[model samples]
Target chain A: MCNHGIHIMEEVKVIEIKKSIFEDNDRDADNLRADLKKRGVYLLNLMSAPGSGKTTTLIHTINRLKDKIRISVMEADIDSDVDAIKIKEATGVESIQLHTGGMCHLDAEMTRQGLDNVSIDNTDLVILENVGNLVCPAEFDTGAVRNAMILSVPEGHDKPLKYPLMFSVCDVVVINKIDVMPYFDFDLDKCKEYIHMRNPKATVIPVCAKTGEGIDQFAEWLLNEVRNWQNK
Target chain B: MHELGIVFYIIRDVKKVAEENALKRVVSVVMDIGEVSTIVPEYLTDCWRWAADKEEILKGCQLEINTIPAVTHCDDCGKEYPTVAHGKICPHCGSTRTWLLHGREVEIREIIVPNN
Candidate 1:
């Protein structure tokens, strides 16, 4: 060891360790998934950037499936509880507000805490409207069985090129605000092509949350996914 | 977007490991960051410096980052290529059946402790 050295040096101990910084979070997410499966709870993570009509869509979705299946929502935000308030007023179902305390995303442990605060004894579906950001939320797995994302018409169709990971990780891509399609010059075919290019297995649904256009298909897909998850 | 939040997670993990191993202090912590990953190394280290100093075990511990190149594996050609340059397409075979092989890592490679 001294051949390449300048002179004699003090002896030192070298310990080799290779561990993932995300190991703990991954393990926690796995445990939470197992626990949710055991309890017959289908958790869906609905993600999108700010002003993507996530709340409005969720309210409509809840109105459609509330009678058939017991549903709850975990509204996560950086500091405000306005979405949770709106959800409670609209759905009247159990809605828990999770403040990330200036954090951009919610991790598995944080989701678990949100779950503990709400009652899931007889709930069939739990939707987690993760913090309204496309970048950070895609990096963390919150133990959700299904991942859904929304992109509004105003955000343009080039979103897939800029944020590829979000599209790749998502199971379904909701192109919200389709009613404004005539005004925005947003080509639905081109956008769908971009999403398919990144994620071939993704289901692209174009909907208008405000006018309730194409929401039936979204509801049907969600119910089918929940049913499949429950059966599995 | 939240490098400080990630730094807190790292500190919590390092603290747990230190406690389990009965380590009083640490010299450095080495990380393997992927090129395609959304994390910014400079932002992470900056956040780490602000957070680690508050904790006793990691007060002056140095943070080292090792960047891992992003690579993609093409199913059609059975070859691997750089993901940043070529993206989801296979450069060798021009196929769209390519998947990422590496460069999404957020790992801790080593934790160096001072001589006893």
Candidate 2:
């Protein structure tokens, strides 16, 4: 049947494309930062390991400063709406929950998606409680104006030495559960030294989320930081 | 793991490229992962294998990782050293005024298609 027909060869083609994997997320984060700045919103990305008392500290912070500034919370977890619900019932402020569908960390794009879920434009403070993980969250920029981490006393003081990247990337470090410092072998001064060794510029705030021992100071510092960020 | 999210991003970008080029299938995706970057190549490949095969075009697509050695440049000493070995401190001059030169890369170096 093909006696008079010409034979044609199927050719495979190779296309070359080089691009950064985080390119889209990074660009989105930058844009989100700019948008937040224009809208006078200060986003604080809070990260830490599981059981770091991030929620307790955030609740304390919200309780202390909600009257002064409009505060909203975006709680991200692998699978749980409990934190967001607790934040709402406890503080009576705007709250949203983000389920990562099993991812251990929140990237800039995920942060932006969460921001879109809530009213981020009108709020003065947007606290992103990132998924409770030490390693992955530090590597992803969540488009927050500033980044902080909560290191509880129970988590040990050598966390900085083990997770240097988290300590180095954070702008502020909160040493939570300081009320139990007497029971644990954690040394505050030594922890501070370790944090400084990793990041000299990080502002270390010691607090007890349970007793609210240093929540006032922490709240004051956060207020000032938010105000300063907005002013800038 | 966050590597799973990254694998999704890779699949998205690769599919977009394949669509634009009118390609039917992809062979492999080469990535330049930094030595100091938080992404582990093994985990990335594991996630890739799980996620990429779900896509019709990326079935059995190989994920090749090219590790970029972490390097840091010292501002005070004007020297470049391995970042993973010495960290933020300059080894030659013992200066803390050092910044990363390259090690945070998580980029796709090449998208390989069958020589179709």
Candidate 3:
């Protein structure tokens, strides 16, 4: 096939894949969505900054629903499984910690692997505690029906302005660490106003996670959302 | 960063394609990165230089990034604007109501190869 001494009217054919490499991850996530739907499991993607009391909120919420429902969590961290260990110790439930190694975000493939270890059958809620980052994690879709973002008081109210994409993508916003509201420069009303401007549909809930304040309302909202999905 | 994992995928896929097609090297890769995707171009470039050097096909390939701007359509005024700005509401109408027209993607558009 190498007889091209000169120009001999060569033919060229380009086969376009027309498929995204991320499609593999999307396919996996779609499978997860189907599995959750079949099992009547409500999946929640919990996102926030590094110290936004995600773990604390998870602890308090799981404690409230521990006896009522079968809850499991997939915790993502950069290095250690410390968060997963903490979640296990706090909730006394089955949780798999996914180590993203040095990656700042967790994509659908990572979540799918974590889901393999945790059984969603006979489970009511499957919570994915995303990596402790605001920007990158928001770009990924983990096939979660509900997207929850935590904003602690110490992180300031200006977070909505700085990282608008994160807040905009979330279905629910939790103002965690409400007990330290007075000590910080955060204005509760101002923060609420910013969030509303960013996303009209997102429900903002303030809670003192460490002190179990307003958690019942938050849990009720979450259960209602899950119930609607289950009923569908 | 998310770019590192993206780089690995790019290299793996491109290398496999080139090998199957009997190609020596890749000259350029045209990638479509959505403006709202939160992937920093600088970080991606840095990661590409480090990761691409390891792949035989993409050892010297130049990654040309074509940014696709996320357009927002205002439901009230029915106008289109580049929604690359964070929390892209309507620039004309002060409505939290809007629709995402494009962006929110990360895909390879085309590839340029060396005929040699």
Candidate 4:
């Protein structure tokens, strides 16, 4: 009875902190999203491999949509602001340049910083041109409502199979360079099949930005996505 | 190519854990690296040496990397095999479809710290 009077404390407090590798970037992206929502702006992360005509697509889209929408862009590259400069010259839209330094992808923190450096006042569309890499960019979510991927026709149809994760993460798949389809052996049905297999709900829109073919559908779809986001 | 970037993440996470535990230095880090993560183990180790060497609190910190193979399981015949060799197809059942059960992980599983 005397020995039973002493009690042993075996309950230790265990703190749970679930953090991701890109936690800092995710937080920054969230802040950017909140800021955009308050400003009534739509943010889109455009991703693709090198030479996928992402810059060219932007040039065309900005030219087409500038009349109706207040468009701004944040361009990400490894070393130069060449794309940003090109966009500025092409569309006369206020553009901000982001150099990823040595990183292959642009995180949300970097996007947020780039957005802060620019003036997006009364901007309806804000496109963040992600660095031209397929893999690493997929892992880094920049708090974009729509993650769009640019897949040029000549890059091979098996690209979606080689990198399924990127295709899976994308909200929209833009098949660029439809103008070059005559020279290449790119079958439209095969590409759509691959995308559907990876992500059934993903939007696949083929566009020849050079000739402005399917640009209207792309614009209308983007507007719908923004409107849907607003409604939500 | 950017394994150094991952090292920064490891350092940041280790610092947070060390601060909470009142540990003065981090001695070692254990990671469960998936085979299909596209991360080179040699590059990761090299990056760890370069970055971890620069830190005074973790100069001699050892990196323990456990390679997790990408294993896929076929639904038709119920076969499990390495993803590298299988190529998403089953050997016994000969199916072009299989689900990746493991491997795709890139996480710092544990950290060893010096006594306070």
For all candidates, state DockQ relative to the true structure.
Answer: 0.49, 0.51, 0.33, 0.15
Model 2 misplacement above 4 A: A1-14, B74-80, B85-98
Count the clashes in each prediction. Answer: 0, 5, 0, 0
- By lDDT, is 2 or 4 better? 2
Question: Candidate 1, after superposition: displacement of residue A29 in Å?
Answer: 1.4
Off-target runs (Cα >4 Å) in candidate 3 are A1-23, B12-24, B69-72, B81-105
State the lDDT of candidate 4 residue by residue for A131-212, as single tens digits. 8988889878887878999999999788888988899899899999998998999988999988876688999999988888
Query: In DockQ, how does model 2 score against the reference complex?
Result: 0.51
Global Cα lDDT for candidate 2: 0.87
* Tens-digit lDDT track of model 2 for B1-116: 77898898889889888898888887778899999888889999999989998999988777889999999999898999999888767899999777788998888888766664
Candidate 3: residue A203 lDDT (0-100): 94
Model 2 chain B: ten consecutive residues of lowest lDDT: B107-116
lDDT (10s digit) by residue, model 1, range B20-84: 87887777778888998888999999989888989998977777899999999999989999998
Candidate 4 clashing pairs, residues 3+ apart or interchain:
none
Query: Candidate 3, residues A1-232: lDDT per residue as tens digits?
Result: 1222121233423334444657776677788788789879888999999988999899999888878778898988888888889999988998888888888877777787787788867688989999898887886778888799999999999999788879888999999988988899999999998888778788999999978998998888887888898999
* Candidates' C-alpha lDDT: 0.88, 0.87, 0.81, 0.81
For A1-232, candidate 1 gives per-residue lDDT tens digits of 2321321142334445577767788889999999999998999999999999999999998999999889999999988889999999998889989999889999999999999987888798999999999998988889999899999999999899899989988999999999888888798999999899888999999999999998888999999988887898
The DockQ-based CAPRI class assigned to model 3 is acceptable
The parts of candidate 1 lying over 4 Å away from their true place are A1-12
Which should have the higher lDDT, number 1 or number 3? 1
For model 2, which pairs clash? A11-B116, A12-B115, A12-B116, A13-B115, A13-B116
State the DockQ, from 0 to 1, for candidate 3.
0.33
Total clashes in model 1, counting residue pairs 3 or more apart in sequence or in different chains: 0
Top TM-score hit? 1
